[model samples]
Target: MARTSNMLKAAMALVLCYPLAIAESEDDFWEYDVRVSEGYCVYRNKTFAAYVDYTLEEPCEKWNCYPDDQMVLEQHCPPPPGYEIPSNASKDAWPYCCSNSTSS
Candidate 1:
């Protein structure tokens, strides 16, 4: 026997290449950052948390050494129905709302 026919052709080439190497493609590779809880803030992964909550000229930017045990993240304003609150608001406005782009 040729070594059991070359070990059955190397086990049929590892069972036909094992499903193309386990068909992978979870965005191939990626990793933004930013993630919080309680008050909220997710960014990178995007969805909610007011997209990085309040800020003061950049309240801790990403990849910018931001993380003093977490800061800014207590957004809460007169926002409810369809949202609103942006009359030249500053002073690190919380829950910056603006629903339908029809500024009133």
Candidate 2:
């Protein structure tokens, strides 16, 4: 009889504490990192320049090491609109127009 009573008490304690344990296991926050690059590349007759697209992923991957689309370069320029060249713009002028605040 004593063994059965102890077993029942243990079962009751587990049942009562299960909800609190599960709630504590829930994730409370998420973290991410933003990456930027000196957006420059040449394609076709014109030079392409602008901040690259912003992306979110697990925090483990370091900058430039992650896949192309996963880096966030949106602070200087946003995406879905790749930077376009202005009319009469010289290739040399491309750097001046598209350059970030600091020079590399």
Candidate 3:
């Protein structure tokens, strides 16, 4: 009887935790970004909103600066949708890294 009770308990535990695991996968990569350090949202030309990094300085996220124009790109992680690492992107103003608010 004890053995049967333990098995039933184990099965119940797995069943209860299954949904929680599924919900976690919904966001997947983006989910973790939310936890990154909070900062102001950088706007891309007062229209499009660019991506956010967990830092205070410009090129807030991990990126490579193009000494000339001063543009940056996701150095470590792959570029997000629409954010293409440009070969000659102007870093004069906001809207950097070819990224916007819609990103991630």
Candidate 4:
């Protein structure tokens, strides 16, 4: 009887923890890709110089090209609740352009 109770408790613990594990994994938003050689990275037929960081306005993403030929892409998430972009703010600018607003 004690063994059965322990097994049930363990099963319940795992069930409660599973969703937390999945959520944690979802927090990893960066996507990685490898290039054929140790040089520049290309996207949409455009070549990005090696060992530099670039931002795209259309998709609101920041990507980096490493000398080792690895590209890391990070897509910026939308502004959180209560966040707003001032009319004067440059939408073309990433991250820095978002600000918290009290009005809504």
Q: Which numbered prediction scores highest in lDDT against the true structure?
A: 4
Ranking by lDDT: 4, 1, 3, 2
What is the per-residue lDDT of model 2 for residues 3-89, given as tens digits with 9 covering 90 to 100?
566445533543353333223222221222323244433222223333322222221111111122222111221111233434544
**Against the unseen true structure, what C-alpha lDDT does each candidate score?**
0.33, 0.28, 0.31, 0.45
lDDT of 1 by residue, 4-45 (tens): 664455335433533332233332112234565654545544
**Which residue segments of model 2 deviate by more than 4 Å?**
20-104
Each candidate's number of clashing pairs is: 0, 0, 4, 0
Worst 10 residues of 2 by lDDT: 58-67
Of models 3 and 4, which has the larger lDDT?
A: 4
Off by over 4 Å in 3: 20-104
What would the per-residue lDDT of candidate 4 be over residues 13-76, giving only the tens digit for each residue?
Answer: 4335333322333332354564624367765555677534465554555444543425444435
Per-residue lDDT over 9-30 for candidate 3, one digit per residue giving the tens place of the 0 to 100 score: 5335433533332233233222
In terms of lDDT, which candidate is stronger, 2 or 3? Answer: 3
